[model samples]
Target: MTGTPRRFLVTATPPTTNGDLHVGHLSGPYLGADVFSRAQRMLGHTALYASGGDDHQTYVVTTAQRLGVDPVELAARCNREITGTLELADIDIDAFTRPDDVYRDEVREFFAGLYSAGRLVRRTWTFPYCAETDRYLLEAFATGYCPECLVGTCGAICENCGHPNDAGSLLFAESAGAQEGSTTEPRDVEILVLPLEEYREQFTEFYRRRRATMRPHVLRFVDEMLSRPLPDFPVSYPAHWGIPVGIEGFDGQVINVWAEMLPGLRHMAEAARVRRSPRTPAGVWAADSGFELVQFLGYDNTFYFSFAHLGLALAHGGLVEPTAIVTNEFYHLNGSKFSTSRRHLIWARDLVGKYGPDNVRFHLGLSNPEHQPADFTEAGFLETVRTRLHEPLQALATALAPHTGQPVTVRPETEALLDRYRDRMRRAYTLETFSVRQATETTANLLALLAARAAGDPGLAVAGLRVLGAQAAPLVPGLAAVIESRYAAATPGTVPELADLLPVTV
Candidate 1:
């Protein structure tokens, strides 16, 4: 909150390992979280960033059904694919633990701790049960018209209408799998709920404190919910692929994927911090009081990040809730949803092959849907890549070659330009409405200006090159590396370590 945050943390709504990750998946959480983390570290702050696969989402079970494999096999396969895509794009995260991996027991322990703290209020409510399957229906499988809105959605919530559905009110049931017990009659069952009514006082305080930092859309949502009687959120039911609820007498039930997911961000941060801290030994789940959290997510999950997760934190005690929630609007592909199952979107592997990672990153950063859903067209992508990354960066890179071999005196004007560049980038620290779009534009405009000044004066070009290299450390690391290497004989310092480019949907 003051002069240089000593420690900071960034977490995103980890991608579900159901299928291929699209550009939409990239820009919303992973890319932006990477940028924020990189920026903080570059500023000399101890920033630890983490995200992982949501391996237990019902989507994974559906995908497993589609692939004719078990959920474990599907999760392992997609987890690898997702991590590979991030590495290929050079999206750096300190920890990317999975619920199916080392973090599994830790996540369960986290829930147990919260439960012990009495943060969880369990009230058995009537839920849909498929007698033939002998398990409670949930998520996509408990599909029917939303009781409140009459829109089609899962028993939990409607993505189309944003209404939280009551499982007991669920109508027609559809099986998550094509197997015999998939289609079934709904029977009444019992499940656990996290009542927001209990968290109202704490949530109001959180809402008030976060008002300055939350995005317009995010703030509005939280405020509306806090202004009313907070609704009770169901947290557990039967699921074939997930953490067991662990509450006695609820033997067969599993924790709702969303409920169990609340602890993941903290689990990741603790895992990363312990490794970085010599005194803190492994297996100890200690809270990092020094590092406050910041979360990045799409607007689609506004309710969960704003309320469900925050409420869980207040109840869990000693847990650090998010200081800011950066919510980006949807990014569509060619005026349509980018659905992986439909195969109507650009794949990360394919995009990198076609545009080169840096070009793809820069173009997508500019096209980020920060406030509203923006359509991404092939022609638009190409033009953005050309006009943004190619033309200007090429001209600047060429000019720096001859002069950057030595530490030439920086021209006064170019030094001023360098200061302006740093200031403009620091402005992105306003997390609620970060603008990769603006950052990219700033790079292009500043580089063009610096080039013009340096072209006429050799000394100015050297300073310009240094500034360019440092600036590149956050937006496009590859270019900065080239600047550092090409001018190694002349320039005295290494290139600033920055990440590659970023993108999302159409």
Candidate 2:
């Protein structure tokens, strides 16, 4: 709310060290965070963009074994692939810190602090056993065929059926050899646990209070996830590829994936602490510190991220709390879940090469996956580019070509339109509740108006257009520059190519 842009810690999972980012990953979580981060910077907020490769667990090791490569070597290769993918998609994070990043020390300290506070419990838990690897599988690598949707990788619960199951209930076939329902050996593993029941009353109170202030759609979700009793989290895993458990007694076990994710906030907080200066923005570290911490995640990860924050609060008496969390449902492509194994993903690299980043960004931004699954079609892509980014932006630039050097005066209509856009963007953070439908609709309407206005008064619209470019440039630097350059070229006889502007759209 301060005129000074509040310091924000924007975070997302670092791509797995094995492959490039797929359309589902981009559309659901990364796309929204990218949009929000870029927009925030345009609004003058000091935001530290942080992300890293999820290099731990059995999946990485199994993939390595399948490829006949060392696990560490495989992870490195995957990390590079993901980083390159993100860069290609125009996701310019400030620090793409990997698991090996210096932040691990902070993570260990954070864990140690929690343990010192009597918040961590050591417990022997039953985990999915993979006889092939002769090791216990973290939920990250565990999958079961959904009895309802009949999809594999349903893990401990069948989301399609909304039915929960214990590890013993699901069948585990070999990775490359086995028949369905064939019984495999099971392994017992020790893992640390974080009890969230301690804060049930606190979460209930917090939700009740937050409900009064948040939009109805958001409260409905909070209620659904909170309706059940909180579960205990296994903080450590038996896998050799992840962060080692900090507990003194839990040797040979890596921290669980859920535990791996909890450190992102603290990592972000430490990043902010390092960047803090005399003019440092507030709310970067402290829970009640007033800074907003927004997380963009998929529906599958809801229970983990949702309670992770509350559990963190319960662990630490007075730490900073997550200000807002945006979780989206799955993204379907041509009526099926986008899958890499089946070559079903609309690769970000391929799409960017074809239509450009700006178009991809615009399309995903418009067809947001915040509320429910959103479809991405070839026709829809072309329509968005033709109507939204290419025509209107070019037309606006063309109209303003004659007035570049003059002390430009914005027409009333242009001023009013830009003013409305500014006002809408002013509320972007407020709409952080993961209702992508609402946010996308609101953003699309503004963008449509922006496109129309640009085409309406090319000459007199220079100042207004440049102002818009400046506001958005912070987020999409390349696109903003493209807009500014094209507008400048509009002087008298010069006009930038429409194709050149397309790159910014991705």
Candidate 3:
């Protein structure tokens, strides 16, 4: 926080390989992360952006069963889809490794390291189980009235009120494949738990010190949890398809997916090292190397990424503590929470094909839902592209085409505008704050302003639009690279045409 870090790690929420992504997913974390990391690199920082597919989730298994395919096949396909979608959207990602290969061993080692270090608690807990299935219920199969919200709920967390309920507390069990009113009884189970209560004091200190700068909703959630007794977090499930923790007695128990993610970051780093020139020094990405660490995530996941993941990292003894936790509120689609399970969402691949990455990214970047749930309606999307983006792209082209090789002086007002753009760019980037919405909007508004003034003063237009290319290089790198290429041909003071440089159709 005091000085520019020697190394920076920018990570988005690791996506599960259960489904394709929607704009809501991108807008929340990935888009901002991509923009920030790109900007950080542009600023001459040694930044590595890496993420991996979350392949061994209970949700993946559930989805696999519904689709009548092997979980492994499902995970593989979904991982490809996710990586492809990100690539097609021109989202910069260095390493997106699957967990099925060399990564699995490292994940188990991380589990062993934490368990041996006394960070994990092995204990027995009871949960509802149907005798007919000969297995304990875990997620949707374990449906019951949520004690926290008094509403029908499934899984560990209550959507209505973000509380991860104890397995023994859910009421009116509805086991998977069981008929209505079927008698489901309690079954005692042993599992590994991350004792958050024990880590509460340290975590509380960390949270309180950084509370003022954290996202409003996330800070409130961590505040509420720490104010009360921090609950014991579970880290083991009976899922047969995940990494076996190899604990002394818990033979078949697998490490929880959430637990795997914390270490998965390290594995991703290791994999990423191979791809970098001269390679990253061993252990640099694994532990606390005195460099700043940042994690971007959505609203529902703040507790885990902030508290649980941080606890795991610290407990392992030397992983860099998260200096900044950038949390986004949500992106609502048609006033409803965009959900993949319900299939009420726009597919990322389809959106990319239709509008092109820059066009679609413009909508998300401009309307990025940071502190509040930003709505993504079809009508609003078209209007924004028409009024905000398309015109600026067109105007820059027309204004710069004539002055392509001409040098001119910029007015004081236009210079002031450029300064404002740089200030906004600073705030919207990695080191200060990961506010992509603000960055996109500021740049777009400035471009529009320049477009209007272009007719009267072509010098200002040329200078302003040229600067716009520089400022926008982080957010839309693919498109910005094209813009920068055209600007490169300009004779020092000349401008880059938006049309000739940019291949953005419509």
Q: What would the per-residue lDDT of candidate 1 be over residues 1-506, giving only the tens digit for each residue?
A: 33655666788788888886898788677788787777777777666777788888887877777778888878888888888888877787777777754566766777777767776666756555566545566776666777656876666766644546666665565544436545555454466667788878888887778787788888777766666687787777756678887777677777777877777766777666665554634422235565667888888678888888877777766676787888888888989867777788888877876666676677777778887787888899887776655655555556545543344555477667678887887776445446777777787777667657655665655566566667656777666666565555443632221122122212
Measured against the true structure, the TM-scores of the candidates, in listed sequence, are 0.87, 0.82, 0.93
Candidate 3: lDDT of 266?
79
lDDT (C-alpha, whole model) for all candidates: 0.70, 0.62, 0.76
TM-score of 3: 0.93
Query: How far off is model 1, as Cα RMSD?
Result: 4.3
Per-residue error for 424 in candidate 3, Å, reads 2.0
Against the hidden true structure, what lDDT does model 2 obtain? Answer: 0.62
Which window of ten consecutive residues has the lowest lDDT sum in model 1? 496-505
How far does residue 453 in candidate 2 sit from its true spot (Å)?
Answer: 7.3
Off by over 4 Å in 1: 100-102, 131-135, 145-151, 160-163, 168-186, 274-288, 397-410, 430-433, 451-462, 491-506
TM-score (C-alpha, index-matched) for candidate 1: 0.87
Ranking by lDDT: 3, 1, 2
C-alpha lDDT of residue 435 in model 1: 71
